[model samples]
Target: MQVSDYTIGIDFGSDSVRALIVDVTTGEEIATGVSYYPRWKKQQYCDAAANRFRQHPLDYTESMTDAVRQAVAEAPDGVADRVIALAVDTTGSTPVAVDESGTPLALLDRFSENPNAMFVLWKDHTAIGEAAEINAACRAAVTDYTKYEGGIYSSEWFWAKALHVMRDDDAVAKAAYSWVEHCDWIPFLLSGGAQVKNMKRSRCAAGHKALWHPEWGGLPPEEFLTGLDPVLAGMRDRLFDETYTSDEVAGNLTGEWADRLGLPAGIPISVGAFDAHMGAVGGEIEPFHLSKVMGTSTCDMLVVPAGHEGAGAQVKGICGQVDGSVIPGMMGMEAGQSAFGDVYAWFARLVAWPLENVLAKNTSLDEATRTKLIEETRSAIIPQLSEAAEALPISDDILALDWFNGRRTPDADQSLKGAIMGLNLGSDAPRVFRALVESTCYGARRIVERFIEEGIPVEGLIGLGGVAKKSPFIMQTMADVMDRPIRIARSEQTCALGAAMFAAVSAGKYSDVSAAMEKMGGGFDAEYQPDAKRAAVYEGLYQRYLRLGEAIEKETHEDRDDAAAPKPDKRSVAEPSESELL
Candidate 1:
């Protein structure tokens, strides 16, 4: 009967953080701000001789401070005081090593140079060797340990990264009181470290990244942890105590964080979670609806209804199958391509298509000129090449696996390599670029098909993220490729909107997540049906995608046999230094 007048959601991505203010009653976003992380970067290659990927912890906190201040400052009048709750969505597997008092160790001068002190990004491949060891252990154990996760471990997870840290740097490992994730730590810091028990952990993060499940007693059994590393088993109790959904109240804001963000202390802070899944919550697709957050990468979320004729057993190859990350009282399925918009961005860089220059040159053009020029160029590109990719009109041999980044689902393997099957002088930018787009769509199709085949039903696809907002060509191309109508989010920043919804739930403005989503989530919100002709055509193309994927994977595995990393890169690294987090 009551609605909170306002809420705030902060979305923390790999390189930036966005803060948004929304009115819960109307679901209108009042103001938002994005702050880029100054020291954040994927990887910088100084030369061909070495490879290093890292991001500074300071960069994340600084950006967080800036994003929050700007959003609160820009909010409508009376909006600040009635703001009842807050939430953050962050990339998973970005682990931080913290000391006994929960302070980040990276700030200390000694560990400043240590890559381990920095957040090990979701895509970091440094732990592949450790992942292999863990995977082998899981395969050997063959217990119920990997039940929800389909019996495999990944390099892009908590255990492998933690083991990598301990095995390489004993001092840092010994000093670490907790091997924490951004999803948990960010909320923890906001609630104040002194009141530990009231702090909540996201079930989404627990199920997907930390290997926590009710069947395995919510984290791999102690014996399993010990088998991976003696140090890992030591923190078992601290890791899995409490699990909260994206909307559940984790704790109230502490005075310190409240002062920093210029909000009243005790404004509710919901437990945080992964960006993609939260994006689904933002888009507000009820159970049986799927949401694809297209960004530098693509992550898919589907809500599995309460009863789906044994659907839980039917689902496969997802990052996680958990309850209530979206629509309350139901299972939320999470999966991803690990690269989508990044492919387009990569092509953008390659073509040196200066958006600025292109626009500048056409400044005097009419509105129709601007819209038509962009859309016409895009339209000509999408259908012509993405579908034509498999036929390989010019060079039949050119093949690629979307793993230029790493794998996220279906036996989550980061050790895997991307492959290009055939190359020749005939290949042009459109050809190569189209292949990139096609491969990613193929990856998404594989996930959707797996969900259906495994018995989980996906009625339709709801689109969100920057890609969904910026490019209709890609969304429609995906629709034709997957043969499902693509639904667009009403909110420009769907994840932020989703976060605000959770903020509503945490503030007790709604009964649960579903109630919050239905009431507050926005969108054009209509489904884009697939074209009959396009769907028929894509069926054959999808078959080729599957075959090409198999062949490329086979060849890459064969090569790895001879040129694998000598030792896991994690073993070669040292401890991250200690630092005081503001």
Candidate 2:
């Protein structure tokens, strides 16, 4: 009798790490476990005001080991021995400075307490100045380094963050020999780790963030780096020129990691990629269908055949379009909002402020009772608000701009701020919450419109991640706003499933990613279709959102020459008014 084969998919998310043990034959998820980073859970080494978020290497190493061990232990006896392959997906552009031996500087005793030596998270925007400098330098160069990177170098990407951290700390700069993305470093750690020059790198992160384009023959020439900053001089050569896609095997797990994970020592480990890209694979994304990994932020993914509509199409203001980034033989396009669930999280905190600070201060109740009340109320705030907001009729007077973390698409700009307009005394918490949700939906619409305008087709939307799975109202709102059907992936852990699919291929279970996906792909959990009446009403509200955003941006950049014409009235003539709709 033949033994069954198994593979493990590990996903390193913003706040936690998850591991899924999957059967290769049927793609059934046998067991899963999640481990939150203790340090990150306590909000250590992060400065929200400075836009700096750093994760220590130990957090990743410990979490990966714990999550995998727990997940495997939950499976049937001998299943761990049957595990054939492993793959990982992580938040991208999250790069950490490492020494010559591929060890993150944060793990070194000398730099253990230094935040600059840790992994700079994708959401970190402290490198705005460095990003701007790169953009300006690229614009002036004979060959623009940003031509493939949406013509704009964002502060959220790899090079900018690395440069900023290096320039900020002389000690870190002197000790750091190279930088490694979170996705790449995790796999290397499992593969018995090698020198920085020999460790494998991911094409997804390199092409999207490091500007490693085929046209440039790899990373931009050393001249471009030297021109941008002498600090970056000769650094490109230290980084590997070759990058691997998700399907390839990075290496077999070494004895150390194998013992720690309680798995076989020689199990194959597939190359790593960003969560959104792998989530696209897990969602069974087809050509032209948009895949959205909606979490703290939203990473919108679109993959098309290289010869299809995306061939040579310069999608203006997208994150980046890279070959083999998602699938082996396709062009993967990325775009996202800098804030999505983060917007809701911020509002939830705002609503809970009185319960903790003011209401709890009135200690008529015992301390424990007050604390319990505050905790319960804090947990229920968003759900109650969503429930209330869902019942309320649409109102044009409630409007907002979803730029709390600045814009990430249709031209990357980090200097913007979020705004809530038309908030008079009548604006209740639910009303304001509804407007914020609408603003996020509107933001999604803008990205879709931009893609369509650029001749890149978005047939329909596929939703992944916590927001897509847990929040029905958010998905429904997105459907109504886009006037399109939204399909939610059936698997709760789609990114991990996607990683497992890649593991299947790397373990030689399937010929390629497509075949593995066909066998193990998670189908739609639910489909949210647009309500004609609600969509029609949202059409007008979307227009108001546009005008409101334009006005805010114009006011913010008053000195710009191409300021938008005078804003239009909030009321729309073509659409029904709030009273009429009600």
Candidate 3:
């Protein structure tokens, strides 16, 4: 394939969609476009939130139109008709309630206020109770179905959210039809003509999230389904069908879709796959190398040449393990941190700095102006905080866990709450900030430990995503926590690049994902090797984090009042100068 005959890779994320144009021969990105999701974050249980995190399906359409148009338009002058194949990867477990016609329920006025009308975004944790029931029931099933999920099924996946909607809103139960992922539906929208016999199932999505397995013929028994929610048990056919992997062409873009997007009809389009998995393909990292897409939350994906064994693992507390889920001949192990950069965002809000602006939060500092005074205080205070954090006699009382947004790995429970210990007048933001940072690293460590315990050797981490790209301190800390070197993938948009790789394969320009990845996917951008000294220091601190974490999980499980106070104060000052954080 010549460079002129390119492929387009569209990546649909939680908050936005990005499309990229790339040279098939050299794996070079030619031009790209990004468009944000129209609906912003939805606060839980608000007036408009009927237990739903809703978004208009139109937002996806608008972004898709703008991104694809610009991506093709911007590619070197003559690259329009040269496009061959298109592939898409999106945020996982993000399901939408669409009618038989493939439109989101939120578009209908009567369903506007109903939360079920909106997409049950991956971050929504309101289904924890329902997830617990599913896990409990899945635990009793016979087929060894839960192994694909690492052993436990998270509420964030398909089943729990569906059950929650059924129980929370009668309108959703009666009015809506198929529970479709945005990944599959977007392609369906573009294909226009006689839709595939069923867009209802995607092997990549269903196998990973919905418990639709191959050997069992489909989803687990109706008895297992009824145990979670009778409604779900009965809608088996509606909820699932034969699943297909990402490599399969779900369908072609019909004439209407082709003209709308300015592409040719019948141009091959691959089945939609999860972003994190595709991202691994993008980063050129393969099995055993954990690809951590650290965004609002962290998605950890590991591919194993062989599948796992854990029949009873789907119970709520057990993390799941799926087989033939990612690569055709390989088993894909997936898990996530319910929150990561979101934790930092929470802290940024506390400091009153707009998140994402690492620079220019402050221009200069002056004592009388207060901004200067605070900046200096913070400057002097951070090192002091670091030293104090290291040297100060931290009280046995000082403690905290990283569950502010809930857990998503190893054990998939979300009813858990966050807690803190050891706070006094002296307790301040720097200390608290450092603690929060450590809590996240320790959380990563816990998951790594779980894999190790299961005899799964994680060779190294191919870290790519917002957190890995931006933070050095956190990376170093993670190295210390994981006791392994961290290799940060070079591509800023590895997910987008991964999609491009898929595009190459779909175009027949490349043979398979592995070969395509090696030729096209750029590898590690930076590597953080384990520092024995730092790792040793982190050892002592990590033990403390564990003690605190255990206390929080235990108390939260008991639903007891959390008397443990978290540190909240920061030096009195205008926001610290941006450069100081660096």
Candidate 4:
């Protein structure tokens, strides 16, 4: 009898951490465990209204340890010892300020309870003003730092978030020596909590979000950063100059971490990356296929061979395209919407407002009864809305824009707001919900259109994450709206499996990512084919969506061209003296 080697994949999500144990030879998931962050679950250090969110380092350490230990313990006997490698994937651009000794400020005794010192989550939008400033400076420079970053800098990305937090809290700014992204920090922690200088940063995070590109050297020039803010000046030297992809090893797991998880010591740990990029590999992405990892937001990942049309092309209105970011030696292109399931969650909250605020005080129910009723109502809201909306007949008059979290693609603009144009007094929850669903699908369609317009043809789409697996109605609607077939990955944890594949490569189990993917890849579970009739109907509605969006864009802001063509050089086109921010 032959024993197979196993690898562990740890995925650090917004609310929880999940550990997956897999058989490297067969791609069989042997055991899995998940643990939600206790503090985050209680809504600590977050203000949704202000768009400020922070996560404590303890939450990450504790949840990851518990999840991994539980997963390894549940596997068959001796499987833990057979684990040869480990890898991690987490949310990107989620950077936290660190002290001189490479400890997160929030984890230090002096700043234990300070939210500003905690990890600034990717969804935080408090840095919008700072982002605009950076964009203005970049536009004025001889070389635009944002050329590869969708020609726009966003508040949700790295530099903007760090600058905002630094300016807001003097203590954090004074104490901080450098910043580190959550993805890079976790791997370093497992490798014995090394200093920032010794930490290996992720190419996926640095290239896509931090304006790190090969053409201008590693990071944006120090002079360019200084032009935006003196506070950001000289910080680049503290940060990394080079980055590594997931296919390489970050380091070996420390003895402490190995003993804590009951796994063998000194196993190779592959470099970390943003979850969606790794998930793309697990979805079996090809040259033209778009992989949509739809959850709260959606990250659409595309990869082409090194010299394909999109490889080094500076496509407008998408995320940065980085070489070797996803699969080694392939060019990785990313585009996404800032809101997907978030739109539904917003509507659900609106529906429950009356029950929570008004009904809870009703004399008809006691505290316990009221709490139970609210819980039940919350659970049933989305499903009930989905059913009622599906029952309603489709109409063009009921239309919406899925920009509740702001638009992230077809040009990155955070000032845009969501709108519903065809609401009447009779437009109840179900009718409006149906329109909202259509709106999200339309948003997705816009991204595909942008890709095609830019000469990057999307041959097909494969869906992963919670939204794809649980919501058949949404998947079918996406198919109809896009007029394309959508396939869902067989693995529920595609992101984790992708990390495992990278781990296998780092451990020398396979020659490369493609080779590992061939053996350990999880195939498609289901395919949703487009309905011709619905597709035709959606075509008309999509045009209406475009017109409404254009009108909204014109009415909402001054004349800063969103559709401007890329300038060959700064000298060729004159720079605007005024800021374009709304």
Predicted structure with the largest lDDT when compared to the true one? 2
Q: Tell me the TM-score of model 4.
A: 0.94
Query: Judged by TM-score relative to the true structure, which candidate is superior, 1 or 2?
Result: 2
lDDT per residue (tens digit) for residues 150-258 in model 1:
5566777778777887787887787677777788878888888653334467888777777777775677777888877787766776555668787677778888878
Estimate the lDDT of model 4.
Answer: 0.90
lDDT of 3 by residue, 468-557 (tens): 887777787788777899999887788888877776776677777777777777667688887887778778878988787677778776
- The prediction achieving the highest TM-score against the true structure is 2
- Model 4 poorest 10 in a row by lDDT: 573-582
For every model shown, what is its TM-score relative to the native structure? Answer: 0.85, 0.94, 0.84, 0.94
lDDT of 3: 0.72
Screening candidate 4 with a backbone cut-off below 3 angstroms (N, C-alpha, C), the clashing residue pairs are none
Ranking by lDDT: 2, 4, 1, 3
For each of the candidates, the C-alpha root-mean-square deviation to the true structure, in angstroms, is: 9.2, 9.5, 11.1, 6.7
CA shift of 29, model 4, Å: 1.0
Model 4, residue 291: C-alpha shift (Å): 0.3
Positional deviation of residue 438's Cα in model 1 after best superposition, in angstroms:
1.6
**Which of the predicted structures, 2 or 3, would earn the higher TM-score when compared with the native?**
2
